[model samples]
Target: MSDTKILTLIEAVTAALDHEMGLDKEIVLMGEDVGKNGGVFRATDGLQQKYGDERVMDTPLAEAMIAGLSVGMAAQGMKPVPEIQFMGFVFPAFNQIATAAARMRNRTRGRLTMPITFRMPYGGGIHAPEHHSESTEALFAHIPGLRVLIPSNPTRAYGLLLASLRSPDPILFLEPKRVYRMVKHEVEMNGVALPLDKCFVDREGDDITLISWGAMMHETLLAADQLAKDGVSVEVIDVATVAPMDMETIFTSVRKTGRCVVVQEAPRAGGLGSEIAAEIAEHELMSLIAPIGRVAGYDTIMPYAKMEMQYMPSVERVVEEAQKVLKYV
Candidate 1:
């Protein structure tokens, strides 16, 4: 029998959680509709039945309480994985996440470490309501002592979530719900965890480099395929761990290509794309063949269902931006 099974990104998440919870009894899950309801996206299906109420818990519809309780539990030596349901709903838990959970280890002089994984479904494209489709990952990425992580595919989702569960610090595990079931990968059940703070180069090319994460990675890859057909060799990178970004890999890619384009589903202003562009401009400007390009969402509130697609960065937009960058000089 094959050890590796085909699983979607969200299924990989469940597999990771189940594997870790079995190995470590100290790990517990808490969130709204996460237990019996299996999470709004069914990411936690059958976990409650397997681990029972204590390990896989369904909490009140209170984001603050969930985060606060996770912080306390983690401080007491328990690995608590709390779900915020949606990224837009996490603001209420900011006090606990930013002020407490993030600072626990440093404040306690390494005596108390918070092994907490705060999970949330983020990004647009699911036709969700007003507060359900925001992709404000930069908010938590700006917080000190917090590791921001986003997985682009099933394989990385499994490995990265396992790594997050085993971490000694607080992590914001942002799941791009848009791609939760967009694709699948054959993943082995071995408890192997991918390294944190590294960029995964999905494709290698010399003409230009494309950097993206989460759901945007899907579009980026698609755009790369399209660009390739037009004779443009595009290097595609998945910025899985956004915070404490692995700029070295990106710099190396940009240095080789001498041109770069960043794609993001979040707003253009104050976005992580801006940070990547700025970093490249600062360190790799001498290697440039053209100005850095960015394809991202607008700086306005994410519109509801019908207009959600319009607000997102499409494959065409990414290609257009890359072409514009390629056209320069």
Candidate 2:
């Protein structure tokens, strides 16, 4: 509802954190460098100054300690937002997240709830060191009792963060490090928080539907624009929440376009795209006019800064897949 301006995705994330901390006294932020350094990406910039060190305390460089402390804090009636720095480093705390935080409510029979939010910058594109850029959303999504929300744009990033903080269950909030400062869009806090299970249709067309999320949304949009210039219409859908996908939107788009091409930065084998492709095949087989295609990263560890682009999905790759699916009709 306001004029659009250039704003970094990290700014959106910081704004959401500040807003939530101010709105809820029980909400607190903790992680390495989150206090003084304001996080590696500066996503928590100035929070320690605003909320004081007690609430925004900086912890040891131990992922497991961060996760365990957050779980205990959440169980004690406080909402703790823990930053994992990078997705690659999150493996150290996988057991705490999977066994303790995620299963707390069920284990306690509703007597205890772990309302902790795990924030991690993920996906390749920034040309960072090897472990710094990884798409681990699918790994977290595979775990039950945890909500996974990955936002592509500024508005959704802000809204989804607010929504995740207020959620009753543990949330895995993955931000695309590549687009953290690339695209800009005006964001208003007046908008309602988006549900965790919903998907968004960025563009509508009759030719083919491009399903994607996280950083890949930007490339998907570029592909759609290129196809538009070539006299081909394309629809773009953002699966903002990978765990509980918006099946209604996905099914409707496939039914209308009759073709789908899922794009993701994760590896092709057993990736989120594979699950989506399977769901579409099982439910919308009759509605689809062509076999669903997937454009994803190769099945290998992300490479160094120079070869990072080769490990993730690119605009040209998405465009080629769209063309292949479009030709099926």
Candidate 3:
């Protein structure tokens, strides 16, 4: 066990990678500016100095090549954690991810596995340019073999990333860029890995189940507090594993609360929220007292600067929606 100290989300990420790389020689970190620069966000800061260039590698600005190289390394028994800079930039690597990395296991009938962790900073709250900010977790989650995990805080980010590296299949580790340094918490440097495909109960309440992941989890929790002050009991669940979701956890909560409000930074159509809503409708329909409410981004492209705030689902929006759901008899 290691002594716990308060650290930012990015610091926790760096510590996890450093700890993992120290323990596993086969584990390698590669990306556009990951080497001497310590990644674009410095999440890999000080790693290159400790692990050296071979383990903490810097690659050309080729997104496809980065992922393709990772696939080959993974197939060859190397654990490659490749960062894609931004979710929007992940487009060039779609073929490698959707076609190669995702299908390798099934294509070979489980003989070989791609133990690769594709890390990317995602979501739009920093007013970054068009390609710097995108919340397309749903697009990647739709892929069959790729497991998607988003962490709301430093501790989970550390544990989940460690787990992703240990898994035999490919993983899309989308770090909520918006909350990277929003707050700090005491995180131990222990190398323990958290379980994947699970929903974590962030706050326990009985009035309603508030479900969300990634950067939206911050907003969801913020709204949960407001609802709490109003005498509404809200149970907040962070759907950390976006796909292969631990629906048992979600269904159980909805069954207890009889009402649900799902929030997402992504657009409404075809987002994970819709999938959750469908499940609630199918399995938990009888338990629901009100029609489920969804708080999500609009169908339009995320705008620039100040307008970005308008594009995302605000705290008020989540509160209002939760209140509406509570009103239904």
Models 1 onward score TM values of 0.98, 0.97, 0.99
lDDT of 1 by residue, 46-92 (tens): 99999999999999889999999998899889999999999999999
Q: Report lDDT (CA) for all predictions.
A: 0.94, 0.90, 0.92
Ranking by lDDT: 1, 3, 2
Which segments of model 2 are wrong by more than 4 Å?
1-6
Off by over 4 Å in 1: none
Q: Model 2, residue 321: what's the lDDT?
A: 88
Model 1 TM-score relative to the real fold = 0.98
> If the candidates were sorted by their TM-score against the true structure, best first, what order would they fall in?
3, 1, 2
What's model 1's overall lDDT?
0.94
